[model samples]
Target: MNSNAIKARKKVLVILTQSPYGNALSREAIDYCLAAAAFEQDLTLLFTGDAVLQLINDQNPSTINQKDLTKTLSALPIYGINQFYVDSNALEQYGIDNDFCVPTIKVDVKEISELLVNADTILNF
Candidate 1:
């Protein structure tokens, strides 16, 4: 009921576990994050499972005539959504080197758990 509480922006965590290019889920999730960021919400984007692929650089989705999601992801900072976290296990599982990914914090499952617990709002895709 206090003014401060009423004006506070919720901490929103977006967990993306799907791969980009093959489907539209990643694109939609990115759109959601951007929309939430436009509202000035505290946003954090976690790339896990196959979603880690979205952070990889130099993707040429244009070969398949699909828009490059990684390119879109690189624009997140402009939207004020720069908190990027990647699951270390997923990176290893997919044989993806972190050097190929965008600016991100490689995290273990335990740290991911901590993030989920601290988030005020969580959206998974």
Candidate 2:
């Protein structure tokens, strides 16, 4: 690599599709992203399909007797992980409004495609 070349920061786009319960994968993803963010990497998260429901507000997994990951997701901003994104139509399809997601996360279906296209790395879970 040329010393003068602009080394782009590692950019990760994580897609959380599965629901946030029953398994540890959801929380794992959140931790992975936050850890990467701690390294000053460019990290972003997206919610699509049925996963949009995971962003619903006031989530209390205790109802199912499991740990709650919603609060963890909400605390991403404090970890330098603020570039969260969610599909607008997916939210509508799942009947979830914007207030349920990370604060000021840009929501849109088509725009999400553009973001994915521009990402250096993408992991769909």
Candidate 3:
């Protein structure tokens, strides 16, 4: 690799589809996102299915001896990650409305499909 070469930043889309507390998948996904952002990757996070629950406010993971995922999610913008998306159908299925821990764009099935097609890389968890 030449020192003067300009590296192109790949658009990375991380799709989280698991419950935040059940397993380590959600944590690992978040960690991966932060690491990718640290390396100057263009990051986008899409929460669908059970993963949409991660956006709920007033999460108390301490009861289960776990760190609060919402707290960590709030710091995403500081890492230059501003594209947070939630599936509208999932939100409806879960009955979540305006109670998100972080700001997010609600996307429909079509939008989600478009996101998947446009991303340079996809990480599903």
lDDT of all predictions: 0.86, 0.77, 0.91
After superposition, which runs of candidate 1 have C-alpha atoms over 4 Å from their true positions? 4-7
Better of 2 and 3 by TM-score: 3
Per-prediction TM-score to the true structure, in the order listed: 0.91, 0.85, 0.93
Per-residue lDDT, model 1, residue 35, is: 84
Best by lDDT: 3
TM-score of 3: 0.93
Candidate 2 stretches greater than 4 Å from native = 1-6, 104-106
- Model 3: per-residue Cα lDDT over 1-125, one tens digit each: 77557766788889999999998999989988888888878889999999999999999999999999998888888888888899999999988868888889999999999999999999999
Screening candidate 2 with a backbone cut-off below 3 angstroms (N, C-alpha, C), the clashing residue pairs are none
Worst 10 residues of 1 by lDDT: 94-103
The candidate, 1 or 2, that scores higher on TM-score is: 1
What ranking of all candidate models by lDDT puts the best one first? Answer: 3, 1, 2
Under the 3 Å rule for N, CA and C atoms, how many clashes does model 3 have?
0
Best by TM-score: 3
